[model samples]
Target: MPYNIPSGSQSNSSGVALARSQNWAFNPPSIDVISSLHILQAQPAAVTLSVSIRDMLASSLATTHSDFNLGITLVQDADALDLFALSSSTHTISNPILLDAAVLLSMQLEVAFVDPTILLEGRYSGYIRFSITATNNSTSIVEEVDLREYSLNLERTGSTTNLLTPRTVNMAYIQGGVSPVLDFDIIPAAASSGSLGYVLSHQGDTVVTLAGTSTSNPPFTLITGDGAVSGTLALDTTIWDSKSLGIHDTVINAIFPDWNVILGMDVNVAVFNAPGAIVAPDVLEFSTLVPDNPQEKFIDIFSTNGFTITAPPWILLSQSSGVDSARIGVMPIDVSNFIQGTYQGMVVITASGNIYEVEVIYQVNDQLETTIDLMDVNFTKDNLYLQVNGYDFNHFLQVESTIKTYDIAGTEFVTTDVVRVPFFNSSARYDVGEFIHESMRWIKDPQAAALGVLDPLSAPARGLYQKLGFVDFNLKVIDRRNQTVRFIRNLNGTKWAPGRSPFNDSNGYHFQNFNDAVARITTEGFGIINIFSKEASSLVLFKNNVEIDSFVLNGGDLPSSRLLIYGGNYLPGDIIKAQINYGTPAIPQLLEKFFVVYPKTDYSCHFLFRTSYNTLEILQCTGKILGFVEYSRQSNTVLKNGVDIINHIQTNRVDPLKVNTGFIPEDQRYMLDVFKRSLAVWLVVPQYTQPIPVSIESTELSHSDNDRFLHAYDCEFKINRDIDEQIYLF
Candidate 1:
């Protein structure tokens, strides 16, 4: 057994060497294994699968996943055909598996990485890599698997921290018989750090640029991590293109009608920004600049927006400077004493390049005039006379003389004589006896006598003489030198008979002659001589004692010695006595002499006599006797006794001699009585009503009647009512 078989045919030996070489190529061992085997025994060549379980498991999992796929194929280089049947078993498995059995079933598997995981941190940089493989089951065929490299970058984007997945190849695979190399850069999305940095920095229409780099072209994209990019950036400068430092919507209104000097006007100015920008230094300046030497200057400024300045201190005015607006005020000047024309001035307003001016005009007026009215006229003296009032006497005098005279006797006489007798044997001298005899002849005519007459030297005497119907004549006097006589003619003419002249005639020698003779005898004739002489003394005694019977014939009381007697003398022994008869039928009879007296014995004589004489016969008889004796007395005694007799006769006489009666007729006496009654009624009537006040007015009617009505408005008050009470008016 151990012996080698003799070498057979040389051709068979060559075939054995070819077979051994083929076996050695298929199963080549290490040198130790070959030495060990040579020392022991010879072996046959073996074929096995060389697939890693992890790789195979990965390949098997990749082949079943949808996100990634794996494919395997076996292709023999000699046949050039894929063996799908040999790879079908491994492909049918759902999970990973190892490659162990082989009957020339070469594995051809495809692997792919599916659903790859990505991770990121705060602001970090890193890389991620995944592996895939492909296997080939065939005779002498090779396969490869590839994984594409992905790079991820993490950054801050918003308030949240996130691992943003970067964009990469979504679908990639490594198949059998292909390159197993994949290269890709990973870009991690910007992560929000939950801080302010993540907020968007752009506002409005601004653009924000985030800085980043990527191996992939166009790597960076802006992401609004959070919705809170709200803050405004810089203000839109376009909106402020027409900006101005001015005012808008201005309004002006007045508070009063007229302006005054001391008080200033108030105004409000409202200013605001143009909707966006804020105003800086919001205060406004309001000032009026007047020239230093301004001539009648005045100004006024006002505003509508709120911008004001401090009021001037010296001016006495009230203002609202505390408001936020602009305003101005004007003061009135006392220009009354200035020029009388219109004055011009200016008001300059200085407010932030805004200027305004106004003109002021002042008018001057003249002073007012005043006047007074007078009510009374002045005079020189208190007492005024119609004749001698005002300037001079001659101015008001209308007559020749201021004094007036009137005749006393001849002009005032009212009697007329029938005839007159011659006086003292002269034709020019006439006796009144003829006139009296004629007057007695014509008893129906009244008798009166003229006592005396007066004459005036200047002016006419006709007015005086005509008042009494007397003729005025100038007569020449014989005895009295340088004496002019004014004679008033008697009523009757002279007449005489033969041997019996009108003068010194017995018929003319009447009781008046006897009176003259007796008065001379008693006062100064023999009666006085007897009282002083002795021879004449007996005659005086005889005459005084002798009582003549005829002397006592008349009945009544004896006459007083003061009475004139006719043709009688006083004797030294003459006695007179008065007896009173006072009783029933009282009779006054002669009794005895009351006293003894002598004529011309003394200058005094008793002329008054009182008696209780009754009986009309005795009174009449005594009056006759006394009348005869009264005419025989001297002119002086006649005058004295005549006045007493006339007074006594006037008192005692029953019938008075009728003189010239007044012109009032007896028929008109009733009318006069009625007028007097009406006057009495007016005086006694009681007034009950108020009197109407009378107003007088005088005006010049015409030139003709001007002088006639010179003294006008001469009014007098008639008492019509009792106006004594005080009246009050409301």
Candidate 2:
């Protein structure tokens, strides 16, 4: 049966039944007819809907369609188109297209197509246009795009090496712009023999050097199947000079002989640096001869240059001098008592080069003794003391004393008192008893020991007495008239002067009394008073008598008092005896009244003005007074007649005038006139009279009867009137 199909669907109108039918015809079939029929029927429905993504390229003047130019590219040996191809839509047209149509359509196409069969063969070659254009339609345009594929092969080159090795051994590369980078294992050389190698090639013909010339070389070590062997390389030239080896040597030596022998004296040896190499010995030895006796010794040394062995000058010959150089010498050679013996000492030599030592010995024969002076001790008290010197002397000394005593009558006595003087060191007490004993021993008289002695030659003896509370009361050296030396010592410490009481009692001895009545006058009030005595005889009475006067007496009135009868007048060749009274009122009181008498040969007067009324009635006189008499008192009316008497004498040169009725000396007439005038003024004149100025002159009178008579009348007038009467008398 044969079947035929028609296009379009059959439709039926209303009310009419429509049916569609196919006819089948049977005939002898030809193969060409069937094949031609199949080809014609598949023509439109078999059209492929292939959509490719490609870069669109458009410039100001041109546009490119590159979808048709897309060709199969391989990526890492796989078909790139296959990456975008859906396996389920390989031959069917029902699947959605995955390719980007806009990017493909915008690209400029170069070769419009690639044969699919060639892609199947893994061989592709095609061109696509990439157009770059400015948005402003500018003419600057570039139209090329490079297409690249990445093929990576990871590998390690050569054998495994330590990580510390330098990276300059193996290398890697990629061809046709393939990025070639690979990570490899860093295996130790002890574990691996070689590293894997990687190769990358494009289409097999364009081969890149497997060990790329541009790639960095990886570090590696060569392994001999055991351990790694480090590659030997040339050292850097910059550091070659620093590596070197140094050698050094030091040498020391003793230049002198090792053994030196000396008989009985100091010996010296030297040490020095040797010419060539020489090592110092740990120990050095020296030799010397032993002497028959014992002695002190020393050793001296010299320097390398042999300079006379002056280092540490004069090495001690004995221990007393201390140690010095390296030489040996004997001192104070007393070897006769010593057995045959060797005396030795060591000398140490030290320097920066080395240290060494040597021994020295010597012998000697002699005698020695030590001596000290005895007079070198300094005694504290030199006169009566003795001191011992040196370490081997006794300190004690023998002592003796001689004493003397004398009575007031000058009788002397003696006594011998022996005593021992004790020795004392610096720390002991000051021996006062020793001082007194020594002082007494030096005294001239033994009886005076209790009374004490005066030894001017012995300062220590004197000092001893002073220390024991003895005072120098009578240290006198007097040459008496009998050619005997008289020394007076008043141990009672008494002194007296005229008019001073020597005892504490009132009736005790009086040192001086100028008047015989002073004893009676001062007996009731005789304690003490300052009295003036004019002459030495007056002082005798004040010292020997006990009376003193109460009336104010003058130096001239003592002779009239008769208390100073014998010595009242001081004469030449009279020795005045005096003493200082220190008891009772004290010595200073007696000295107040005592005065040295001087002779009054000429007449002088001192007149004191008592009244403001200066009257011409009294006539001043300058002469020695001979005598005086007192007159009876009278009234003013009666004294008025006395003024007439004075007027009578002055007016008339009459002898035996009433006022001059007495036998007046001719020189005394003027004075009698003055007296009578003063008496009249005193008795008859009214009170409160105005004063009249009067001149007073003191003059020396000639030693004549006339001057003497005038002086006598003046004194008599002064004695009759009180000082207030304005009377001038001398």
Candidate 3:
């Protein structure tokens, strides 16, 4: 009241009354600025002032204060507010008294979140004080200073001591006695002073060893912490040897204050054992042997521990018994003097202090009790026909012969042992051993297994006969009856001879003026017809210019010399007519033709057949033809045929005959080579019908004496035919 001043500040009675209030007089007017600020660790804290001078003072005083101003000061560490610098430390308060006489002054001061200098973890203190000042013209300042205290409470909700993600520690493939390293990796989330601890838990192939074992001492030096957690796990593999041959699954847990991570470990150990056993075969039995030339048999012996051999002279050991495998061969010592009886012996195989016994048993036979006979032997001036006695035998009859079948155009020659032949026993039939030359013929029907009383003409029997490469055969019967040897040879000539002809023969008939001869042939109930060559051959039949049926000739090597014309069924005086063709001189034609005929047929008819016919004529002279031409791929045609049309024909032909030939006897091979040198010394007959020259094809070692004498060998001869000339020569 220092002189009731006539001023705007004193005009409001409420302002005067507020100044008189004892509570306002005793304490500085201030508002609660902020409570304890809870914040995340490593984050800043902030406060915005809600208290104003107008709210701190009475409303009349706030409205009366025209020049009121607010002053704000942050009292704390200088670096406290560095994280968020306050935009301004002091600000002017806007007075409403100047505009409205009843309004109170209300304003705000903004303060940003500030980070503490020390990175305070718990609670940090700071203060913001606001002061009011007035120009004394109208606005009144009730309080000089207002203090708002705040505290920042930093709580560690997240941790800095973080453990890296855990992974598997694999102790890769290990051997029973080997030690390998267990490898893994780890990294700290950030720089930390804390250490990581690992605990290993596993069983079997994997184990933890201790430094020492005692009643008072621990078995292992426990690995509490390695200071470092990222490195290779170097471990001893010998630990796996304790329990080998399986998988060891283990876990390694990394321990830390904040987290625990488990790492997996798998250890696989393999088994390795030492070697030591003796192995041997069972009993060895030698069934039968021909005393003249006995064969040897072998029994095998093996051992893990090396040893030596102890055997008789008759039992030959391939090698001295040792760690490796060896063979024991058994053969009769005095085979030449062995009588026809059963023989027994023993063979001892020893290894690793172990002995094995192998028994040897055999039976020797001096001669075979079998027989063969040539029953129907017919000899014509041009060819000879022979029938083998159909009597069956218990054993095979070793056959060694050459066969030759004749026609007008070509000839065929067959040698023994060139193909697998079949043998017939009382019960069943079996193909002869690959290189064995044996013959058999079942007196009973071959198809009897299917068809009772099987016909000899049955297709099955005929097929089997042809299948064994034996349409017909001239075979030698040695050791057939009481071992009485019989010699058989196939001859291709005008008469039966002891040896084979060097060349095949052909029919002697020259065809010319066929068109003129057709008229005369018609008067003789025969008419000539022009033939055309086709891929396959067949004939059409007609009676009195009326179309009848057509028939195909059975394929495969038909003889050019003989032609058979027939219908499925016919009656006497049916007066059948037919036509056929061979080939013209076309570029791609396969074979040439000859014009000839037998008695009742027109001789001028064209006759054609492949040059590689199984039975074809190779030589011809005067009124006779010699067939029985056999071509062998092993015959060395280059040396025999001298690269002519015969070589070309044989080269183009497929060899259906597959035979396993043993090594030629050394002595016989040398003799054959010597004889081959003197070409004139050879007896090669001249071929008159085949226009192209023929030459010796082969001089092969003969198997005729295989059973009787091992060293005794004979030489067989063969020749190639000039089938290209068969076309015009006939």
- lDDT by residue for model 1 (1-730), tens: 1011111100100000001111001111100011011111122112222232222333332332222222223222122122111222344433432232322323322322111111111121121222232232321222222221122222211212221111111111111111111122211122235522232211221122223321112222223332222221111223222334343221111111111001111111122232111122322211111111112211222232222233232222224331222223444344324543344444333333354434343333121111101110000011110111111111111111011111211122122211111111111212222212211121111111110121211111112111111211111111112222212222121111111111121111111111112223332211111000101001111233453322211111111111112113444544432222211346532222133344542221111111111000000001111111122222323322122332232221221111111122332222222222121111110111111211111112111223342211111112222323221110
RMSD of each: 82.4, 68.1, 48.9
User: After superposition, which runs of candidate 2 have C-alpha atoms over 4 Å from their true positions?
Assistant: 1-392, 422-575, 579-730
Worst 10 residues of 1 by lDDT: 614-623
Candidate 2 overall Cα lDDT vs. reference? 0.23
> Which candidate should be chosen as best, given lDDT against the real structure?
3
| TM per prediction | 0.11, 0.14, 0.21
lDDT of 3 at 502: 26
Judged by lDDT against the true structure, how good is candidate 1? 0.20
Q: Sort the candidates on lDDT, descending order.
A: 3, 2, 1
lDDT by residue for model 2 (262-302), tens: 01111111212231111123222221111222223333332
TM-score leaderboard ranking: 3, 2, 1
Segments of candidate 1 deviating more than 4 angstroms:
1-301, 304-338, 346-359, 364-730
Task: Give the per-residue lDDT of model 3 (tens digit) for 1-730.
Answer: 1111101000000112112111112021221122222222333444444432334344344443444444555554433334333443343433222322223434344555554322322222334433343432322323322222222222212223333233433233334433443344443333335544444333323334322211112323333343445444433445544555433445443433223333343332222233223333465544332443234556544333455666666555556554433345555555556677777777777765777777766565433332111211112111222222221332234433332322122223232222211122222222222122111122111332232232212222222212111223344444333745434444222211111122222221111112213222221122223222212455555553444755454322212122222211333344544544333536322222222222332221111222111221211111112232434465644322222334444443422211112233432232233223322221112222222323333434335445543232222223324333333210
Q: Is candidate 1 or candidate 2 better by TM-score?
A: 2
